[model samples]
Target: MKRLILLLVSLPLLSSCSDQWGWYVVDPTTKTGLTNLKFLLSGLEQTVLMSFTAIAISMVVGLAVALPGMSSSKGWRRFNRVYVEVVRAVPILVLILWVYYGLPQLMGISIGVFGAGVLALALSDSAFQAEIFRAGIQSVNRGQYEAARTLSLNYVDTMRFVILPQAIKRILPALGNQFVYMLKMSSLVSVIGMQELTRKANELVVTEYRPLEIYTILVLEYLVLILAVSGVFRWFESRMQSDER
Candidate 1:
């Protein structure tokens, strides 16, 4: 809060000096500047929506993939290793390009901009999430499984009632980090024209011809978003730990 207050206080001083620096285009008090600011902020909706949807899908896919890594069957375990290695190898920008273009061409099915964005982001992040879950599950006390067995609990019941809750808490911080990663990576979808924050800035730059000022806000938008998200995650993590204690 103090930092934010300091930043807000410093803005006018920076803007006032813009005249000497010849950067008057971002004078937020001016009509043109205010309009540009609003236009950029409007794009935040698309950015947030795309990120949230992608992370939700990633969590589901990641857990499914992570489970096999813990299986007794060698085939399932090998498949898990192969999946994590192969998927994590792909760069997000390349994945976004492939999903938006090559996927439709090969499958004879097309997803729109938003769908492609979510699909690409989720697929790319799921590999990391899988690893996080795998480690989290493995970190659980082996005695947990023995206790479940002593109770005559089936494997499914064991995971559902005794394992997942603990694993989720252990892995949540990593998951939260993945979400922030997904949020930033969503910008790559701008290349395919999702009209999210980056795309919005790109378009505004073309017309407004003020890349410096426009991009500064663009940076701040993401910075504020990431900070707010990290803070929430930390608070949530602390609360969960408190509950456990």
Candidate 2:
């Protein structure tokens, strides 16, 4: 991964001598470029914060929704299906726009750009998270539930103590994938003026007139962020596996 990143970074430098390519705009060695880099990096905090907040909310919401889908009652199962279908049907961008713009008008309550972005992202992702959780919960062996019943564990207690922990472990990879997806999707919030990584890159492109160079850096930023997140998930998975043994 380090070698790949080095190669990608060096590819542009190899062509730096060409007059057609203006690498000076993002050149770390220069004062202007270094300042621009810092400005771009400044948005990382908002991006990470927003994505984490949204994913956290989504996980809870998803678990709640997933429990209903697992219920034997047809009404509850229908409700779960309807919710997942409706939420997933909407494009995330449209949902973001509506939450930021339309929702405020309808509710007669103001929501800031960050709040709206998080809400929209959480709502949109919760649908998929529900499915992931449902699958994970259902994947547990039937004997686990029988054992819980024998121990006099009620539905809630069974889920809380016996089922959810195992389900969460099984779904950790999916959850991590969702988080990475959240990070990427958070970039869309830039359109609503959240000033995240892509927003910062877009602003810089307007100022520097170097779309290729600026966006290249943006790609690297996301690449590094997602790679780091994936590494953490892998570490957690290893730890969990060791604990199981």
> Which candidate number has the best TM-score?
2
Q: For residues 1-245, write the lDDT of model 2, one tens digit per residue.
A: 97867878686877666766777888889999999999889999999999999999999999999999989999999999999999999999999999999999999998999999999999999999999999999999999999999999999999999998898898999989988998999999999999899999999999889998889889889988999999999999988887672
Candidate 1, residues 127-209, lDDT tens digits: the string is: 99899999999989999999999999998899999999898888888888888888999988999999899999999889878
Deviation of model 1 at 47, angstroms: 0.6
Mark the regions of model 2 whose C-alpha exceeds 4 Å error after superposition.
none
Q: What is the lDDT of residue 85 in candidate 1?
A: 99
User: lDDT for each of the candidates?
Assistant: 0.89, 0.93
Q: TM per model? A: 0.94, 0.96
lDDT of 2 at 213: 80
Instruction: List pairs with backbone clashes in candidate 2.
Output: none
- Give residue 214's lDDT in candidate 1 (0 to 100): 75
**Residue 189, candidate 2: how far off, in angstroms?**
0.5
